[model samples]
Target: MAKMVTKSILMPAALAAALDAEARDKKISLSELARAALSDRINLAAIESRLIARLDAQDEAMAKIIALVSSLEAVDEPEGGVTQ
Candidate 1:
């Protein structure tokens, strides 16, 4: 097991009520639900950042490939524009 420390967060009544309701609906403690939700959101944010960075890095390469394809000579339709 990993060592853990307890922390407390304060929220508005409406948000707290919503979280508590969700926790009850799922039959889990509010603490567990909040932990899982918070962890998932943080992980998704990090993954999104990494994905954007990778795509940005490839932006130039992708543009070059597109330009190369566009610069290719267009071929006319062969033999009545249809063939068996």
Candidate 2:
């Protein structure tokens, strides 16, 4: 089991009320709900970061591919004095 430490956070009253209601509805303690929510949010952030990085890498690769294709097309073009 992981060691747990206590932490405090401040939030708007409305948000706190919502969290309380959710905890009641789920039949869970407020601390447990908050811990689970925080864990889920952290995980989601990590996934989003990885997704953004992948998209950036893909964008770079596409740009390189487009440049290569353009160069090839330029090479394939006939001189201005000729047409086909």
Candidate 3:
């Protein structure tokens, strides 16, 4: 198990009230609710980062393919509009 330390955070009064209401409705302690929410947000951010990286890689690959095809077409065309 990891060592646990308690930390305090400040939020807007309205947001705090909402969090309290949600915790009460869910029948969980405020700490538990906050911890779960924080964990979920962190996980979601990691997933989003991985997705962005993959999309960037795919974009680079598509650009390369497009450039290669364009070069090939240029090479295949003759100056006199004649077919080989």
Cα RMSD for predicted model 2: 14.8
lDDT of 1 by residue, 1-84 (tens): 111111112123434565676678778897887687787732434444554454455665766787877655224336465456
- Per-candidate local distance difference test: 0.53, 0.59, 0.59
lDDT score of model 2? 0.59
Question: Which has the greatest TM-score?
Answer: 2
For 1-83, candidate 2 gives per-residue lDDT tens digits of: 11111111212343456567767877889888768778783243444455456545666786799999988888888878337
Worst 10 residues of 2 by lDDT: 1-10
The CA lDDT at 11 in model 1 is 24
Q: Compute the lDDT of residue 18 as modeled in candidate 2.
A: 55
Q: 1 or 3: which has the higher TM-score?
A: 3
What are the per-residue Cα lDDT tens digits for candidate 3 across 1-84?
111111112123434565676678779988887687787732434444554565456667867999999989888889776585
Candidate 3 yields a Cα-based lDDT of: 0.59
